[model samples]
Target: MDLKSSTVLITGGSSGIGLEIAKQLLEKGAKVIVTGRDRAKLDEAKAKHPKLEVIQSDVADSKQVETLKQAITSKYPETNIVINNAGIMRKINMHENRALEDVTREIEINLMGPVRMTQAFLPHLKTKPEAAIVNVSSGLAFVPFAISPVYSATKAGLHSFTQALRIQLKGTNVRAIELAPPGTDTPLFTGDEFTKEDTAGPKPMPVDELARAFVRGLERDVEEIRPGVSNGLKWLSRIAPDFAVNMLGKSAQNMRH
Candidate 1:
């Protein structure tokens, strides 16, 4: 709960939301370590934030996660927080021809990565007096984004997993937190797969602002931090399920033409 006294490890910390989170957490006096699959990007992130500790690790790989767990638990024994943020979003047309492995890429990184990380680090986190596991899901978890079906499914799966994990960890020192972000101005959202027309809804939230919101939520001990449109998405999904799904599917209809 005390950000100042926390030593945090964030996956996918080289850029976008994860990087901003690392920056803010460091400013709060927390020792921040970030992991990314790309060495060059990790170096660049370190160059920008001199205080940040960078590690090259891929969450999609089970072996890398095991290595990361050993490295962090051994080196940073005081680590109390782990943020599972490494993920990718793709605009996949399920009907189109694609390799079988390629179709489940998001599942490996976005969903299973956190599951593996949690399993690997749960014991270490439990030993700490104050510990938390934060999963970065998406607003699309509540309402499927037809264009990015796999990405949406992964987030939705993560959201469910976090809920179950929270219940399983009840009465323990560890806290399970979920941060479901809305369309944020990040590389993942504005990447090659998506165009301006696909994201014609509300303007994406600024990454820095989203990070600040995340920090505040953690400080307040909020279990699920849904910023911006994420909260609305959850509400709509429950009350107007059909309309919510249709609204999200509008862009996909255009892609089919």
Candidate 2:
């Protein structure tokens, strides 16, 4: 769908890929509203782009998502695009002693967040003449990252969910698109426990370049926009699923402390 003149809501748009996407969309003449959990970060993002509408909401919380849906729909009735970009990732050693809740955080934010947001916004999106839902999954969705098993699993689930959503939304105004990003230079990968070596394959994609690729993909109507190593991962998963899994497992072995 043409991005110009579209009203877009991007979750976790305060920084990283989401922020980059918002910046590009604004440049493309789209009305952009960005949501984040931190009010300070949201304010900072707004400071950078005065035209950006910043909302403080946690995608992981179902109640907050409901409230966010109502607030956005009421104020920005023209909103026709929803980008489920808010997510969290952790490098957890499953064998280590850890709180149960901590182990599944990726599921809550990475997987369920988009699922709930889609449910909350699909009805409104369908009302528009043309609308789109972009879910930012990961290349790991096709092959498990052994070091980040849960994160990979959640992304895999999200990939499946997006495919189903696309099929279900067939014949409707809303179009579901999945963006399976390769490792990107974002805080999600630079967290305390993570290092360059910890990443399963190559260095992260530059955030700006990745964002540009996404916009181009959307303009071209690509259903699954897998950039860089992500595209390779998709192909590898299809032709050499076992080898791909083994290679990723070896990468995790290299990451072991």
Candidate 3:
């Protein structure tokens, strides 16, 4: 719970929300190790924050996940916090032709990636005095976003998994926390990641604002940290599931039309 002397590992920490979370953690005196798939982006992140210990690893690969687990456990034995923040999104048109492997890339990274990472690190995390597993889900987890069908499905699955994980780990030293963030102005949803038309929704929460809310949630030991519109979406989904899904789908109708 106390980040002052904690050692943390964040996957896909080179850019976007992951990078922001890593920076805020460093300021709180936590030893942060960031892993990513790209060497250049990792280098850029390290250049910005000299305190970061950058490792190149893809969470989507089982071999690489094992290697990362071994490396972190062996090298940074003090690591008590693991953040499963590595994820990707796209505005996919399912009607278009594509390989099955390519069609399910989001599931591999967003859902299975966190599941594998948590399983690999659970033993090590339990050995600590206090530990935490943070999974970054999405606001879309509450209701399907029509344009990114696969991406939304993965997030919904992750949300359910995190809930079950928390129940299983009850009375344990390790805590499972889910961060369901609304659109944040990150590379994940910005630039060429989505077409200009695909981004037609509520303005994204500022990255710094989201980071602040996240740190506060950790300190307060909040189990689910849903920032900005994410909180509203969850409430709406619970009260009016059909209305919520249809409203969100309206924003994505452009993709089909």
Q: Which candidate's TM-score is highest?
A: 1
lDDT of 1 by residue, 54-161 (tens): 999999999999999999999999999999999999888877888999999999999999999999999999999999999999999899999999999999999999
Candidate 2 global TM-score: 0.96
| CA lDDT of each prediction against the hidden true structure | 0.96, 0.92, 0.93
**Which ranges of candidate 3 are over 4 A from the true structure?**
254-257
Identify the candidate with maximal lDDT.
1
lDDT of 3 by residue, 54-96 (tens): 9999999999999999999999999999999999998788778
TM-score of each: 0.99, 0.96, 0.97
Candidate 2: tens digits of C-alpha lDDT, residues 1-257: 78997999999999999999999999999999999999999999999999999999999899999999999999999999999999888777766787888888889999999999999998899889999999999999999988888999999999999999999999998899999999899888866667667764577899999999999999998999999999999999999999999998875674443
Sort all candidates by lDDT, best to worst.
Answer: 1, 3, 2
Question: Candidate 3: worst 10 consecutive residues by lDDT?
Answer: 248-257
* Model 3 pairs in collision: none
